[model samples]
Target: MYSRFFSLMGGLAAILSVSGGFGLSDVHAAPRDRDDVFFRSVAGVWKGPGEIVAGKYKGTKFTCDLTGEPLDDKQTGIKLGGTCRVGVFSQPMSAVISQKGNSYEGKFLDGAGGKGLDITSGQVSGDKVVVGINRAKLNGAMVARVSNDNSMNITISVKVADQMIPVIGVTLARDIDQIAVGSIKP
Candidate 1:
């Protein structure tokens, strides 16, 4: 469960990398307005439950507590750090992403070389981000969708032969808010 979920997440394994948003080449120039805004919107503390929906780890459920921070305003990207807990075990997780040229580059944990995956490339379209991930002989994709300012859903999938299979699914909600607002009365 840990290996697969982390591998899947070790994920942002690409999504977070894409969100933390990083680049292989030297990041130059400025990012698009939407890109800038996207990263900023994801900046905050997030927590939620996740499940390994497929493979041998099917039915495995866990939870993660993560915090996201937007990069410098000049750059379009984000960085995420936190821990994922499963039963009595816990793992430290981190991801970084940046925009280089027209694409994005980043990595999860220490990248594919260590215990996490690498963010090869990514693109942000409206409320969601799709990132390419790779680790040794395995190749996959992570998609993160921001349903609203306070919610996000992440899905991680690996390429099997000629198919992309979903392996992990996570739903995150912001845990902290700068200010509380009054509700409207009907």
Candidate 2:
């Protein structure tokens, strides 16, 4: 089950790359946002169960975790090419990370069949962190945000690909005011 999921993620990364997210011109570039370090520090290993919460997949749940390193060097097309793997999987899936201007993008091979999973587009402003994904199939916004050290939130806006309607929306919010991170592994 694990292999199947990660393999799909890997293939997705490849497709996203081919789709012009990180072309040859962007295969290598310096990390722009300084928050990359902060994000990386909190990125280690995290695992938690999450429910679909909204949309056709609503109520569906999965145990997910994400693990990755900070891309401080000027490298793209999978960052370390073999070292950086983040997401819920036993084996580190191939992740392509690149930075352009003040924003950073990551493409992951969501698994074998060349279908992408959770492609991320995010930016950092001051102590606030905001990230989002526009799924091709789902056709909605999956977004999340975090404050310097006291707050974090995630939201999923349901988008129907077939009819182009938003059926549902879900949001998860927590204040670092209490628990440790209070975050579900992405």
Candidate 3:
């Protein structure tokens, strides 16, 4: 049961990686100014409701609270920490993301007593970001698009057997008060 929970958390993190507005790519290069601006623009607290759209957990609903903080002054990276709740179950999650040139890389910690999830590749454009994930038994991609400064939509898909299935979809809104006054620690 715990393992399943971790998998769920990992999937959620993948979704957050995209929804959080961080970009990823496969190249090693210097960071770009526009990427920095994009990350900074989305840095803050976000809260929303999400639903599992496929797989075993399909139809399960959850609420998420996530916080995005700059890892450095240059805005080259961001740290994400938060929790998601489904009925009586609550899971904590975190990620450390860094941008170089037009590419992005990051490590996702599901807070489920495991190493972490590796974000192998990703890219950012205008108000959107996409990231690829590689895990022991699961592989997929997450895509996010910001509709405005305050709202965004995220979709997470996982490769099951030989087919890609969309597993989660969420719509998030920036919490201005939480961002300005700071959020409660998870």
Candidate 4:
């Protein structure tokens, strides 16, 4: 059961391109995006496969389809909503990350209060956004990186003492519906 939760957490966390946990006291404010350009770059439909790499559910595979929408107005951030499928089971997941003061804050699902994780802290660096996640006693971090406008990679790790153990990895590509072109013979 713990394996399943971690796997899902990783997938859900990845969908938002944000969220995870280090130590409460060790938490530090992540640098804000200059003009919040990172939000704009992740806006789109992303779909791909994920896997649990370590721990009990090693090699467990799943697929996720997530859509990211950059916030309007002066707010700087993005909201992602999607569903992940493992075998015949499908779970709904969502995340919202926005700039708050000099740092970034967000949550996944209902947060720790319900059954989700909280974004304790986050920062945008170049093409990647790394966020700290927490839930009751679980502590870890996740990294989401966007590349070439259509590809993204996300990794979720568990904090162990002084090291972070990677538990999940996902690669999502922009979901584009392609239309085939055909010409009638003259």
Candidate topping lDDT:
1
Model 3, 7-39: lDDT tens per residue? 555546544534554343222433475566566
Give the clash total for candidate 2.
16
User: Which residue pairs in candidate 4 have backbone atoms (N, alpha carbon, C) closer than 3 angstroms, thus clashing?
Assistant: 20-132, 20-133, 21-133, 21-140
lDDT of each: 0.73, 0.37, 0.69, 0.67
* lDDT tens digits, residue span 6-114, model 4: 3346335444443211111122333443525556655667778888898888888988877777778689877877778778877777888777876677788777766
| TM-score of each predicted structure versus truth | 0.83, 0.49, 0.79, 0.80
Q: Which stretches of candidate 2 lie over 4 Å from their true place?
A: 1-33, 75-95, 110-113, 117-120, 126-128, 135-138, 147-153, 158-186
Q: Name the lDDT of candidate 2.
A: 0.37
Error of 3 at 155 (Å): 0.3
Q: Judged by TM-score, which candidate is best?
A: 1
Please state the error at residue 120 of candidate 2 in Å. Answer: 7.0
The candidate, 1 or 2, that scores higher on lDDT is 1
75-180 in candidate 2: lDDT tens per residue? Answer: 4222312221323334444565555556556555541124444545655444333333443544333333442232233344434544434322222222223334
Better of 1 and 4 by lDDT: 1
lDDT of 3: 0.69
Model 4, which residues run further than 4 Å from truth? 2-35, 178-186
Ranking by lDDT: 1, 3, 4, 2
